[model samples]
Target: MATADTSETVAHNPPCTRRGSKDLPPDLRIVLLGSSVSENSGVGNFILGRAAFDSEAPPDVVERVGGRLKDRHVTIINSPQLLQTNISDHQITQTVRECVYLSDPGPHVIVLLLKHDQCSTEYQECVEKVLLSFSERVLQHAIVITTQEPTGTNDILQKIIQKCANRHFSLQRSSSPDDLLQMFDNIVQMNDRHHLDCEGLQNFSMTQQPTEIFSEGVKLNLVVCGSDGTLKSAISEQILQQTDRRSDMELHGRQISLVELPALTRLSEEEMMCQTLRCVSRCHPGVHVFLLIIPDAPLTVEDKAEVEKIHRIFSLSINKHILILIMQNSEHQTAELNKQTQSVIESFGGRHLFFGTKTQVSTLMENIEQMLEENGEGFFSTETFWEAHMKKLEEMLKKFHSLQTDIQSQGNLPKGQ
Candidate 1:
């Protein structure tokens, strides 16, 4: 039997190319979610090699436009900032829904924009909320884009950001538009393999069990925070047993994933606040434990005030996550700092430990374990929790400004009115 008409078989099979398969989408549809409209708009223009989408004055609902990027037709949807605005989640979901139909099929990719310069508790929460709103199936198509202009030296930061979303890119990182096309090509390939967006995609994050928090394994996220000009780094190094070879300040014990943060009193307390919160949300996603480091020296008024501010910022589930770690200059110096810091410890529910040296973190770690056991990692509402944090920050900032105004006005009051 001569092989059944090879030409006919080949013609019928056609190797499953786009032309041989079902009708192809009119163009590539991508929805730009999250904040950073200006930067994202710029990125959209960059991808298309032209100013296709206007970044000015983000309007409510959704805006969809098509452009030509390289040889392929591309459709870009720029969505408004959801969490920061009055738009309800329903409205946001509906806007995303509109995006699906605007391209005549659905988005093959969702570009989530996260700005490096503006990362904060609110921003991270907004990002998590928006991304988490989507179903897990959509996440496979999701890509996080950071606005940080990457340099050759930023490989480590790039990797960290990439881990947060599983797939990440920087417009500034790629040398040219070709690099971007390659990324889009990969997305298209993977999307084609999955055959996603045959129907309008839904958005939602299922609630995780509180007990599942600690059961997630050895990914311990310990935040070492203190006032500006304190010995947070030094103390963290000691507690984490960071050897000379491990001088990066990250502790990689069999059971601990410790990260030492700079003083919360740094130039941008707002920035630091967001950085801390983002660290928890992205790196630690399950359970977060805070090591509130206080120096052994006298508790300066500034240190006390900074401690108060940290407390206010981390008010959500703080009672369960925060631990007071007092760093003393010497064994004898611990006595003085202990007495001086009684108020701080009391403020933190009297769960305090004084370490004359670095290896003294065992008891502190035990205390944290106990706290986790008791708390079981309660429900965390990303949007509500962080919006509340921003409100508290604003209130504290307003109060500080008011107090400064009072003091200045008092100085001007002739003869102490």
Candidate 2:
């Protein structure tokens, strides 16, 4: 059996040959969809031949882990617990996006895990909802894996299996890793080696298209602000240079403009205010997204102060439009995040990504699009900027008055002498 390799290291390793001569793709991507985290993670671990995913990971967050299995590089995307009755549609949509994002092009197999004896209408409905969340044709690429022997009397389970063209497997009956690998291969072969079409996965239907956020005339204005000035400049330059820029300097077809903002701490108070106003003006009506580039290192006092200044200038609500871009050093990438870095991310609504040196432009754009979608296609408008400015003025005025009152009270107090 092939042992699991660390996901971080898996990408850099060479692909191995598979057991058969079926001419399978080098990568086998599988997505685990189930109600039980333990069952899902267990199956994931079983397939990868190691415990790569955390069974205790938040039920709302989808995770992906990759490893080399025999001759093929296998990637498993563990979806959030979507079968619960209380799961919201938004949560479902978010999970679908994350799954698609993690799976990249798409998963080759959708493995639905379930207990053999557990059958209920609600459970079936939830399963259907999840399956349809990807696409109606997703069933063609699906397989049902039951914990125990699937009995003939379980109508719900039978119907699900039938819907999936009877592609079923018993985890208990499958004794070796090869059995599971073969199952995945069968699905790949049945589908003619084509992965699930992800172009439509963004909208949950083959016919539906993603909203035209970057419609012909509208340009996406991005402001790259962060404590790490060098990283910010590098990211901004990379984005501008790599994208297809037109004669007018805007990106062709989908227009995108990137502006780099230096650390506030480096600027004098007057320069800081002027720079903020200048950025807002250059972005015009609004800034679509603020890619706050933080180096993949512990936050220094200057970094914290810069972040605080950003919050003060943009208001706490600015977090809705902020996306943390952690510039990771390829040689120093670690599994664990810095505590202060994590806290900074949490403060910004947990919107972050570890941007390695080799990260692509598409990945950054996708994150920006996801953040925009979450914010209801809204941006930090000029009105919002002024509102935050006024709020800051109000706070300063209150503080000034309080200080004046304290001074008066001290003068009125009995002589300290």
Candidate 3:
């Protein structure tokens, strides 16, 4: 329901008075990304100004909130370089390292600020690579926060989201401190839950034994792309749960990162490609499948063109794989509706795949397995890591298996039997 509904309200304003100070960790590392043109770029200047002029400004909000300041803990760094030229891989990597990596205190969260202009393809690709490198070290630790002041809905912002798989937030009409604080809290909570959930999946245990050899080279990296957070979150959570339940299955672990591609009120093909390339470069190399999460809604000519362009870009590489997942809402399924949706996606070179309305556990498992097979990875039959897990499970459940067999054979014999 949250659409870019207004056309005359996008205005860039100067920073307003902030409310209660942000209660950050005694000393926290904050990283902000933006261009020189953005109004909020003056954050550094504002901080410096407050430090120098406001001697009576109550003890720094961070200190008063029972936070600790370990040495080399509080650091704020911004990329000094621009993405205007030489978007080569080497240049992009080096710039990011210099700006983002060198900060003594690493960032807990990353905030991306954008206005309404389209980005060049070179810049987009460079940014994508930088993000990928960042993820290698801090996968679940990354959070993309998009901020937009009341101005016309930005096509560039929407493109960025589509490409980067980051989260989005808006600061439409007001610049109130309470709103800022609330947004900050949401970022912290979301990041905390995401990291914890990933850790859980990465550290799950099993109760079985195995004797066969499995493929060690195959890595199934699945990237699910969509605009709706509800559908995205639901699909990702279900995939994780299903993978955890199947001990015998060669589950190629899932890494669910959301890309909120910016969709401006106006359309610009050049800007869209640039942003998409940037985000794609950050993805895992083993990401054999790209799931385009499309909601069943009427598509505009511009929307259709955007899809066509993205498809062409993705298809450039024979190694890159892509799929279309058209998620129909809670409405009754009809033949005509299905036909219309399928045609729309197929026009863009994507196959229309459906995951049942409830997206049941069975459906999740089957869909993943099918994807793995199409991408040339064999069934859940061959994973050495999983074999080891099976071994462990077999050991733990060995006694129970014998007991159950005896009871079944003797028609419910007593435990002593």
Estimate the lDDT of model 1. 0.55
Ranking by lDDT: 2, 1, 3
**Tens digits of per-residue lDDT for model 2 on 1-417?**
112331111111123343464578898889888887777887788788877867665454466789987677999988747666666554465467567766878889998887766668888988889888887789989988776544567888888888887777666632566666776787787788899986675533111112256566566777778777557656765564455332433334455555556568766576577667666665656888888888888888888999988887778868889888888877987657878998989988888888876777778777888887777778787778888889879999999999999999889999873
- Per-model CA lDDT versus the true structure: 0.55, 0.72, 0.42
For this target, which candidate reaches the highest lDDT against the unseen true structure?
2
Worst 10 residues of 2 by lDDT: 6-15
Q: Candidate 2, TM-score vs. the true structure? A: 0.50
Residue pairs with backbone atoms closer than 3 Å in model 1 (clashes): 121-274, 133-203, 133-204
Better of 1 and 2 by TM-score: 2
Which portions of model 3 miss their true places by more than 4 Å?
Answer: 1-30, 33-105, 108-214, 227-230, 241-275, 300-305, 316-320, 335-340, 348-350, 377-417
**How are the candidates ranked when ordered by TM-score, highest leading?**
2, 1, 3
With candidate 1 superimposed using the best TM-score fit, by how many Å does residue 106's alpha carbon deviate from the native?
Answer: 27
Which candidate number would show the highest TM-score if scored against the true structure?
2
lDDT of 3 by residue, 1-417 (tens): 111221112222223332323433434444545544232333322322222112222110011011123222334444423332333333333334433423333455554544444345554565555556445535334433333443565555556655533444453433432343344344445454232122221222221111122144334444555444345545555555554565655343333322223331222455454444434443334344556666666655644654555544444331225566666656744334455556756564554566545656455435545655665653221132235446657876987898889768898666786
